[model samples]
Target: MKAVRIHQYGSIDNAALEEIPAPKLGLDEVLVQVEAASINPLDTKLISGDMKDYFPLTMPYTVGTDLSGTVVEAGLLAARWKQGDRVIARLEPGSSLNKHRGGAFAEFVVVPAQLLTTAPTKLDLATSAGLPTAAGTAWQALFETAHLKPGQTVLVHAGAGGVGSFAVQLAKYIGAHVISTASAANADLVHSLGADQVIDYRTEDFSVALRDVDVVLDTVGGETLSKSYQVLKPGGFLISIVMPPDQEQAEAHDITATFFGHRSHAARLDLISGLCDAGKLRVIVDRTFHLSDMQDGLAHSASRRARGKILLRPAV
Candidate 1:
């Protein structure tokens, strides 16, 4: 099997495509003939050691997490899935519960069956590869954490990007007044995705233009995250996917602050897939690259300007 991997954490230049043996199946895992995988910011962060304190990597690590593929073999203990089943999964970063095992940027991958969910029936397996992490993160933050309600106003930063795109759509689906920040060029794109208002971040400061927001989803941390607190009304919420929110700022502003770390699980992926199949959700793919072009794909993801997910087809 051909896989893109890095011997050590450093840069995208360290990632290379090499032929390696197919992974061994675990008692509760399945072997998948990988069709496509999506490159995420987390992929680059993991490769560069930015997240080492949280998700320490094992040497010679494979470089992807989100994937859609067909099951070719199943372990004896993984009877829930079988050969020919099309599935989408987000492999979790190494934590105490799950060991580090990221090999999705490959021709074949062995994944714990518990992480696999049936691919959305309305989407092709290739497109479905973009759903697990991006959409799941938006779903978890809006519903699970903030509990955004209908008629409430929510502001999503980076509206044209992966998670932001989903957040705009889902917030609108839940009947919230969705406002999003995007460049002027992507204004129409974000509006079409359900943002009621698309603020041109380059032209206007969102904190000054909008106020009394019920929920602010901050994808751009640092200065932007700091300014987000000013837009929220008293008792509002600020949720960050990038880094932890400053507790002192939260108390001073009289708003709740939380940092969301996305969890990948079959059940959450299943719910997201159902929404996609029902036409309430959509996946926006920014670009697709072959395994040989792994560096270019990683570079694009690292740029952080993608409209949505960047996909990699391993079998290409």
Candidate 2:
């Protein structure tokens, strides 16, 4: 199998595509023939070895986390899936997150049944590959974490970002008023994703433009998430995806604050599949790179200015 591996953790230049033996499925895992995969910030974090605190990888590590693929083989325990089924999964622990596992950057990957879900057939497999991490994170934050309600107001940081694009659509689907921050170039992009208001973060200060937001989904941490606490209603909540919110400050403002580390729940992925099929959810792909061009893809993701999800086509 041809796969991208981290010959070293220092930089993207250290990643290489090499031939390695194909992965064998465990009793409860499915072997997927990789069609496409997507790049996420976590991939970069793993490449730089920054997530070593929670997820320590061995010296050699394959680097993909989310992928859209076909079921080439299924374990006996994975009775629900069959060969030839198209799927998308957050290969939880199947990447650098766990030292023992390889990843979807390869020609094939074996992932646990728990993390597998049917891909949205409405979109191409390459685009569907972008959903697991970014879209799932947004879904977890907006509904499971924040519980955004209809007619309420939400301020999403980096609205044109990977998670932000999904957040805006999910918030609007919940019937909440959506306000998102992005560069002026992406205002229309966020609006098309269902955001009711778009604030040019580069040119406008969001805290100065809005007030009493019912929920704020903060994707960017530090100053942006800190300032977000001020614009929420007394009892509103702030859900930060990147880091933990300041509880003391949240209390002072009479609001709730929490952090999110997204999980790949079977139910959540099922729900996302339905939304995408019904056209209520859309996967946003800013760019795509071939499996051989993974280094370039990683560089683009690390650039911190991607308009939406960055993708990798395994078949290319």
Candidate 3:
């Protein structure tokens, strides 16, 4: 099988597409013939060794986590998923357990049966690959962690990006008044995705323009995150996916804040799939690359200019 692997953590240039032996199935695993996989910032971070402390990897690690494909084989105990079942899954990046193993950027991958979820029927398998990490993280931050409620105001930074795009749509679906920051070029795109207001980050300062937001979803850390605390009302919530929040700043602003790490949950993914099928959710694919052009894909993702998800198809 052809797979993209990094022999040692360094740069995207280190990633190579090469022929490797097919992964052997485990008692509780299912083998999936990869159709498409999505590239994320996490993939680049893992390859660059930026997350080595949280996600330690063995040399020659495969590169990817979110994938959508069809089942080709299943272990005896994993018979629940039969042949030809369309599935989507997010492989663990080894954050909690500190053991990274990624194989989504390949022709085939072995997935733990428990991690599998039925892909959305409304979207093609290639598009469904965008849902796992991006949508899952947005869902976790808004619903699971922050407990965002309807009729409240929330701010989402970089609302046109992968996780931000989903966050805007999901927050709007739940009846929140969504505000977002994006480049002026993406203003219309962000508004169409359900953002009630789109602040042009390049020309406008969000902190000075908005105030007393009920929640702030900080996808852009550093100065943006620092400024986010001031926009929230007292006792409001500030959730960041990029980095940890400053406890002192949170206390000063009388807001609750914390960093979020997305986890792979079959049930959550199933719910997302349902929303997709119902047309309440949309997958915005910025670009698609052939599996052989993984370096270009990785570089594109690292550029952080993608309007939505960047995907890789195994076949042409």
Candidate 4:
């Protein structure tokens, strides 16, 4: 099998595509013929050794986490899935418990059956590959953590990026008033994704233009995160995917704050799959790259300018 791997963590240039034996299946795992995979910012961080404290990589690590493909074989104990099943799977990052696994950016991969979910019937296998990480994160932030309600207002920072694009659509689906921040060039794209108002972050200060928001989903951390509290109403929620919120600031503002680390849940993926079939959600693909061109794709993701997910087709 052909796969992309990083022998040492330093740069995307360190990643290489090479021939390797197909992964051996375990008691509760399935062998998947990789059709499509997607890249996330976490992929870049893991490559650069920046996530060492959280997701320290095993040297000679394969480079992807999100995938959609067909099952070729299943383990004896994995009876829930069978040969030829079309599915989407996400390998949970920092899963200290599972040291032996295969990366999605390969001709084939071995995945724990429990992590697999039925792909959305409305989408092709390639596009569905973009859903697992980005959509799952947005779903967790808006519904699970913040509990955003109808008629309430929520601010989504970097609304044009991977997670933010999903956040805008999901918030609108929940009937909440959605406001999002993007550069002027992406304002129209964000609005089309269902944001009620799109603020040009480069030209306008969101803290000054908005007030009394019920929830703020902060994808951009640091100063943008610190200023987010000013827009929320007392007792509102501030959810950060980047880092933990400052406890003192939360206390002084009388609001709840939390840092969300997305966990791959089968149930959450099921709901997102349904939403896609119902047309209540959409998967935005910024670009697709062949496995041989993964370095360029990783560079694009690391650029922080993609409007949505970047995809890789191993079979391409």
Candidate 5:
């Protein structure tokens, strides 16, 4: 099987498509023939060694986490899944650290059976590959962590990007009044995704323009995160997926603040899959690249301008 891998954690340039042996199945794992995988900012960070402290990788690590595929075989104790079952899974990086296991960016991957979820019935498998990390993170932040409610207002920064796009749609699907920041070029796209108000980050200051928001989902940290504290109503919630929120600032603002690392939840992905089947959610694909074109895919993701998810299909 061919896989995109990094021999060492340093630069994405170090990633190359190479022929590698197929992974062996474990007693509690299933072997999946990958149809499509999505490149995430986290994947790039992992390859670049930026997250080595939290997710130490053994050398020659395959690159990717989120994938949708068909099951080819199951291990002794993993009979819940069977041959030809369509599945979506997020291989948690923390779970595989130091194990030297290959990831989703390959023609075949071994996944712990417990992590697998049925793919969306209505969406194509290739597109569903974009859901696990991006959609799951947004779902976790808004509903699981913050418990955002109907009629509440939430501000989502970088509304056109992967997590941001899903955040906007999910927030709106639950009847929250959604506000988002994006370039003017993406204003229409953000609004179409259900953002009630789209702030032009390039030309407008969100802090000065909006106030008394019920929740702020900060995808862009640092200055944007600092200013987000100002927009939230007193006692409101601020969830930052990018970095840790400032504790002192949260105290002064009289609001709850937290930074959460996204974890893969089969239940959450199940719900997201239902939403897709119901036509209540969608994946906005920025581009699709073959496994052989991984360098270009990584570069596009690193550029941080992709409108939504960047997908990778295994080379035939």
Candidate 6:
């Protein structure tokens, strides 16, 4: 299979393409001919060795954690899936829980059957590839962790990026008035995605513009995450994805705080798929690249300013 691999982890410039051996099928694994995969910050961290403590990779490591593909073969233990079934999965990075090649940037990936979920009919398999990590992160943060309720108002940062786009739409679906921060260029785009109001972070101070939000979804950490508490209602929640929330600030503001790390669950993906099929959920794709163009796609994700999901098709 033609896949991108890091012979030595460093930067995107150091990655190279090679024909690697086909992955061995485990008893609970399914062989997927990956149609596409999307780059996330996690991929960048892994490649640069920033996450070595949690994801210790061997010298020659393949680096990708999301796959959208068709099942070319299934293990006997995977009775629910069969050859030619289209699916998507959120992989456990460098973890033993799944045998999926870090090679989602290649023509094939072997994911655990438990991680596989049927692809949404609303999106082609290629686009469906970007849904797992970004969408699931938004879902876990908003509904599972924050429990944002109807009639409440929520603030979502970087509304034009992967997770923020999903969070903007989901908050609207839940009947919450959604406000998002973005550049002036993305104002209309974020509004179209269901943001009740879009604040251009470059032009205005979001904290000065809004007060007493019911929930704040912080995709930008550091100072942005710190300032979020000032706008939340007392006892409101701050769900941070980029970094840990400031406990001292949260205490002073009388707001609850939690950092969300997305978990891969087929059941959760199914729910997202259902919403997409019903026309209630949508995937915003900023750009698409072939696996051969992996470097550019990854660099774009690292910018943290992409308009939407950046997809990489493997079988190019």
On residues 95-214, what C-alpha lDDT tens digit does candidate 6 reach at each position? Answer: 577643366787888888888999998788898888999999999999999888999999999999999999999999989999999999999999999999999999899989989899
Residues 1-316, candidate 1: write the lDDT tens digits.
8999999989899999999888888888889999899999999999999998978899899889999999999999999898999999988886333454677899998888888899998998999999988999999999999999999999999999999999999999989999999999999999999999999999999989999999999998988899999999999999999989999999999999999789886898899999999999999989999989989999998888899889999766
The residue ranges of model 4 lying beyond 4 angstroms of the native Cα positions read none
Candidate 5 TM-score to native? 0.98
How do the residues 71-127 of candidate 4 rate in per-residue lDDT, one tens digit apiece? 999999988898989899888876743454339889898888788899999998899
Model 5, span 1-316: residue lDDT tens: 9998888878788999999889988888899999999999999899989999988888889999999999999999988999999999999888752144438999999998878999998999999999999999999999999999999999999999999999999999999999999999999999999999999988999999999999999998989999999999999999999999999999999999999999888888999999999999999999999999999999999999999999999953
lDDT of 2 by residue, 79-132 (tens): 899999999988765344323443878888888887889988888777888888
Q: Clash totals for all models, in order?
A: 0, 0, 0, 0, 0, 0
Please list the residue runs of candidate 5 whose C-alpha ends up more than 4 Å from where it truly belongs after superposition: 96-102
Model 3 weakest 10-residue run by lDDT: 94-103
| Model 5 deviation from the true structure expressed as Cα RMSD, one decimal place | 1.3
Q: Looking at model 6, report the run of 10 residues with the lowest lDDT sum.
A: 94-103
* Model 3: residue 11 alpha-carbon error in angstroms: 1.1
lDDT of 4: 0.91
Across 277-312, the per-residue lDDT of candidate 3 in tens digits comes to: 999999999999999998999999999899989999
Off by over 4 Å in 2: 94-102
Whole-model Cα lDDT of every candidate shown, in order: 0.91, 0.86, 0.93, 0.91, 0.93, 0.88
Higher-lDDT candidate of 3 and 5: 3
* Poorly placed runs, candidate 3 (over 4 Å): 95-100
